[model samples]
Target: MHPFSRSQEAKEMFQAQSHLYNHTFNFISSMSLKCAVQLRIPDVIYDHKRPMTLIDLASKLRIHPSKATCLYRLMRVLVHSGIFAETVVPRDGKQEEEIKAYVLTPSSCLLLNDKATGLSPFVATMLDPALVSPWHFLGDWLGGNNHEDCRDKLNNPFEAVHGVNIWDYGRKNPEFGNTFNTAMAGDCQLMNLVIKDYKEIFEGLNSLVDVGGGTGTMARIISEVCPGLKCTLLDLPHVVAGLPESESENVKFVGGDMFESIPSADAILLKVCTLGIALL
Candidate 1:
């Protein structure tokens, strides 16, 4: 073999190895983001009202002195991922010295607890063990090793891991059920932006049904945007049970299964249903 060809092959092999290593460790980024959200780092930074130094942030988080260095490392990863921004600012007493401070980036702004576009609940719920555990069994489920009967109704990883579907699991675990509901509502906050850009879609429609709408967050947004349009929110009986009535005359809630029947309406809105059982 030519010497140049051998060198070129070695370079390509090293590149492939680097690519593989990156993909294998990509979950660290997601887990780190989850950790940040769990600690309410975004909210803490926003409450600070300015770029916050590492020491001040550690103090605000009530982290121990021993863990301050670990906090810095975590923040470094978040800053690299663009979840937070780092800036150099003048030290309090040292005119010639500067310190690195953290600020909220556009992505982290959505994680703020009090913001209109807040999705902290969604982040927490999605990263919860109940949801993430399914991924561990995904390979087994796909390979038909998780179940004795491949033709069984349990066709998804969540069902294979938990021995029941997500809906049933939610019913069995009330706390997780509430968390999931809150997360769904929080996730729907993005619809506010969508409605603003596409308000014309609802103009001709007199009535619309939001199938499997959890707690009517999306329905309320639509109703407010299109006051003339009537919006009906339909979901499982247990999901809509004991919910307070909507203040808007144009919005109403109904308890029913989407598989059996859906309320009649001029338009049907189905958003985020594909991951309704698992990821969403």
Candidate 2:
């Protein structure tokens, strides 16, 4: 083999290994980000207008001075992943001794809990151990026997580990349920912001049904914006049971299953629905 050809092969191998290395260490990125959130690293940066030096950040985190180096290592990884940024700030107006200061990036800004529209809850919920532990079952779920357990009629991973379908789980556990509900509401809030861009769809519809519309938040907001359009909120009995009484005469709530039947309406708003029911 020519010398250059061997070098080219080695370069290709190096490129392949870099991709594999990224895939392997990706979990560390998630774990480190979770640690930063638990430690309130983003909040610390937000509170400190200027960049925070490693020593000061450690102090604010209540970590011993001895563990400062380890925190620096974690910050280095976060900075590489674009979660945080680091700058070399002068220690005491001397270039000889430069201190590393951390700043939150756009990605990390979403982790702040102080902001009203902050996605900290959604991030925490997504990273929760309960939600994550199920991934380990992927192989088991694939290789193991498929049991016909119908206690909750889960029929899938989200339902199996959660002990109920995603919607049912939200309904059954209101506190954790509300977290899921608010996440949906947050999405609707974003959609509502640009709703005017798609007003034509709703313009001619005399009535609409929102399937799996928990607590009627989306329907209520829509009805308020378009009082002339009658909106029906279709969800499980438990989900709609305690929704506040509607002031808009056009808006109505119904507790029922979407698989067997969806209440008749000119248009239907099917917010995430399970394949199990959708196939039926």
Give the top-scoring candidate (TM-score): 1
lDDT of 2: 0.76
Backbone Cα, N, C clashes tallied per candidate: 0, 0
Alpha-carbon TM-score of each model against the true structure:
0.93, 0.76
Rate residue 136 of model 1 by lDDT.
Answer: 83
Off by over 4 Å in 2: 1-5, 88-98, 145-154, 159-164, 167-175, 215-217, 224-227, 245-253, 272-280
Which portions of model 1 miss their true places by more than 4 Å?
145-153, 273-280
Candidate 1 lDDT over residue span 50-134, tens digit each: 8999999999899999999899999988998999999988899587999989999989999988876688878788878988998
Residue range 82-119, candidate 2, lDDT tens digits: 99998888897797898879998998887777665566
Q: Whole-model lDDT for model 1 versus the true structure?
A: 0.87
Worst 10 residues of 2 by lDDT: 271-280
* Whole-model lDDT values for every prediction: 0.87, 0.76
